[model samples]
Target: MKLLSTPTRRIVAISFFCMLAFQATYFVGVIGCATYTLGADAAGVSALVFLLNVVLVAGNLASGPLIDSAGPRRTLLAVCAATSVLGLAVWLAPVSYPGLVAAAMALGFSFGMSTTAIDAYPRYFSEDAGELARMNSLNQVATGASVVVGPALAGWVTTWAPVQCVFAILALAPLPAVALVWATREELTAARGEGAGCGAGAPGAGGEAPTQDAVPGLFVEGDATPAPDGRAGVRGFLSDAAEGVRLVFGRSELRVLFFIGFLGFFVYGAFDSLESLFYRDVLRVGADWMGWLSAASGVGVVVGSLLVLRIPKQRLSTRLLAAILALVGVGSMIYTGTPIVAVAAVGQVICGIGFGALAPVRTTLTQQRCEPGNVGRVSSVMRMGMNSAGTLPLLVSPALAAAFGPQAVLFGASTLAALIGLAFALRGDE
Candidate 1:
């Protein structure tokens, strides 16, 4: 089919390869170290997560606007190239704390920047909601594949290779991304956008302007508006950011999403940060077993993302979200209470599914509720929910777990998570 010959196919393929390089090298080399071993103080893990959040927020907040200006392909390619370079730098860098922090920020910032950039790419490629969902789902699936592979490969580096060698390997993942960018150079050009993307300004559409539809996190300039610098004006950025903020307070959907993002981060942040530790310390499982658990969690993400498409949009309810999350909590509670890795794998899968369902649903709704002109800004604002909570809670949960106990902290955290889910379920979006 000509579709196979088209830019969409290439974009999806290259984008996925880029993710594989990123996820593996990233989780294995840095994130693994950043997370505290059960042998270490639990607070170490929390602090690592906190650092990740701070770096991600700082980088993404600034970069998100840039993506809005540069367009997705350019932004995505730039981030990938930067990451590949940074990974090498990490490999060669000194081992002191300052060096680590600097290198970590470079790696982290590149990864975070890439995420925001690539995420917005689909907006420039797809033509309708179905296409958008398909792209998102495909990207999610790619992400799942990376999650499964990243640790297993990296585990080898973490074990056999000098820990520093891990960065060398991490540096390689971006190679394909770079090559793909080059080979497909023309595809990412005006021709790649030959077909319509989401709306209004889609490149073709028989010379008619892009349809005036709203897409969160993808704010376009004024209709037929092209700035000389190719960036949104300061006024537009601030105004759009402001609109999303106002919506967060005034819109039922946005409010629910923000809270849900917080709860997810607060509860799941600590839990995920401790996954390796749970196996080693709590269950006495080995690295292979730990890797399997992580893989299983990846499956959860794929399954959940796939399931989101089938979900009836009209029936969306906070109560239902609560129930789903409550069940996820149950799975976690069972694992912790029983100290079973198998059981925890099940919980991870459920949580993954929940994440998939919640993320797309929340994003779609948030996009739908925002003003057509301010999609990108609003999306970024709404995103702050998960980002803030996900990163911040890492600081607290690990410390709390260390001070108290993993079992106690997990149990309490599970309760709080289920409570948030239930509150949303009962209260709905409002």
Candidate 2:
């Protein structure tokens, strides 16, 4: 049966592959660079991850206005082109630590922009809750597929070829997306027009209007005033960004969603510092195993995404979200609690399922609850919350990992996440 319309399918396909390309480059570059260029130094790897996330936070802050002003089509085209160029530069240039760091920053920013654009696409294409849920599920499928292939591909490639070649291949990956997005220009423009009138406060949109204090002067009375012109300078941009932040926190539902997402990612921060080392030190395996285990997790994510599709739309509730969060934490504990490679892979899959299921639920809730006109900005605020949460724990994770072995540190974090998820689930917060 045809689930999504032709245009929607095309858009989903483009987003899927584009995100795959970007994620592949990221995984390959980070793993290859860490293993080969940085000589497997944990501290150096931590620094790279920290810097990349810092730039990503900046990119998320800027992308909301770009999406709201220029539209997702334009934003996608620009970021994809920039990513391809950055990849080409890294491929051709000398492989110095400094060069890699610069490339990582560029990639991080482009990634942040592209992610916000992609997330906002569903809001533009349709307003139906079921359709939005389907779109988000498909998007999460793309993420899962990328997670499966990218790291595994990285691991396999690093086993034989020079790390430089991976970047060369990455240079070609986003080119297809550029062409695809350009072809959809007219469709996207029309969709954007339709979406603007479907905001929560619109006559038939079926939601209470946001409070005056939600965005102060920006959404004066019940109308969403157009943001100041894009060329209106930094003050205008900051105003737009601040509006997005306020819009998210002003609503009780959005605020709760943001907190849930933040907690999930905050728990993930430790993995940046300790995951690879877990493979080497705990699993007592080569770096290649990390890719394979990650792929296993990706497979689990695929399963989880499929499960979401089968769920009754009504069942996709906050309680389900809480359950999935707890599931993920349990999986993480299983993943890190064991020293055996086979056992770790099992844990990865279990953990992957929770993550896979979690994305669509959170995204669908955010999309459904927010005003359509401000979807892009709202999504960016959500992204910023998660990214910042993910980034902050990095500051202390390495120290924790060092003091207590990587496995123990990871285990403790997982336990904490599980406890939090369970608490929330039992409380049944709406």
Candidate 3:
């Protein structure tokens, strides 16, 4: 049998290339702009990262409702257009620190929205636990493939051209996704149908959905009160957003999953602040090595995600997720704990496996626990937690790196992550 249907394959394709564009433009472009423009100043880079995360938080908050109200396809089309426009504008404008900062904010917000839409798309396709797991793993494979290719492409571009030029090329990256999504719009939207919204007691294999009494403001399908005016519309949106938050935090299973994701991304936030510095100062490597190492990690992600595909459906669990988290932490510790470039490359591969495996597992768990009507909002809530966790440490990472050195600070962070993972593993079922 074919592993995925024709429409499902198209969805996967749209997700892959759109994320590839995002990875190249925002992930690499922001850092490259900071490094080349700011002379690799730690403070400047941290500020840029911090700004991106802040805007990302806001975007995610807004996107959940947009996706739920407007539908994921439309929301994705709008963000893809926004990304393209922002990239072209940044490319045309004379390169300056201020210009880069503005571009970062716009791009960061778009990226945040795109992330929510992409992740929530799987639920729109299937409610079956095994199918959801398979789709999520494939989606992660797309992400891993993008990670492998996007940075390497950016690294190559920087060799012969200025880093600013990467944005110009990235301007066209989302155009294909726009065309593809628009073409497949009706079929994809139709798939959402009546089953998209789940009522109370309709949880997936992971655990029970929040009861009506437990989640006071949960958005029940067919129960929405019509708004009389524009002001009511605004209030309605806020109410929906608030309901999403309550749904996530109010459920016991979701709460544990939320904190697990928060801890994982907390480690990544520190990486955002100090990882490039670690490359330049600690390993004494050229900028290209950063791209190469990221690509290595991407390879590991592919391997780990593929591994997830081979596991029996009966074996998927929160305990397994905790073990994967611990593995990721150990890989990160190895990556940062040593001075040898080869050893670090190995560590990147190991760490990448953890990240790759982590997404499918976490997403499966969240989908299993979430109501269909609130999928977009619930996904956004989880993103908000992860992004908020990521944003918080940036405020102090520069100082911590300065006082303790980047290598030492990073190693400590990794160690803490491993211990948290182990602790969660010991706690048993969600």
TM-score of each: 0.75, 0.73, 0.74
Tens digits of per-residue lDDT for model 2, 1-430 = 1543365675677676676666666655765567555666566667778988889868878998888777778899888888888888888888877887888788888888888888886665555678878977677666667778877776676677766666755677788778777765533455334334557754467965444343322222344544467566667778889999999899877887888788788877878767877776777766556567878888998888778888887887777788888998999999999898887888899998988788779899889888799999999999888878888877887778778877898999899889888887887756
Tens-digit lDDT string for candidate 1 (1-430): 4644655565666666666665555444554444322234456545555666578667777787786556656776787777777778878876444555566667667767777766666666555788778877677666677877765666565555555566776578887776655544432234323323534455444445543333332334433455556455766767777877886777766677677766765666767566556656677754445445666667777787788678787766555555666665655566565577667777777776776566666667666667778677667776676666666656676667677777777767777777767766777555
Higher-lDDT candidate among 1 and 2? 2
Better of 1 and 3 by lDDT: 3
lDDT by residue (tens digit), candidate 3, 100-130:
7898888878888988987776666555678
Candidate achieving higher TM-score, 1 or 2: 1
Question: Is candidate 2 or 3 superior in TM-score?
Answer: 3
- Candidate 2: worst 10 consecutive residues by lDDT? 212-221
Full-model lDDT, candidate 2: 0.76
Ranking by TM-score: 1, 3, 2
Q: How does model 2 score by TM-score?
A: 0.73
Where in model 1 is the C-alpha error above 4 Å? 1-5, 34-40, 61-78, 89-99, 120-137, 155-168, 186-243, 251-254, 272-276, 286-290, 365-381, 426-430
Off by over 4 Å in 2: 1-9, 64-75, 119-140, 188-260, 309-320, 361-385, 423-430
- lDDT against the true structure, per candidate, is 0.63, 0.76, 0.79
Cα RMSD for candidates in order: 6.3, 7.6, 7.9
- What's the lDDT for residue 11 in model 1? 64
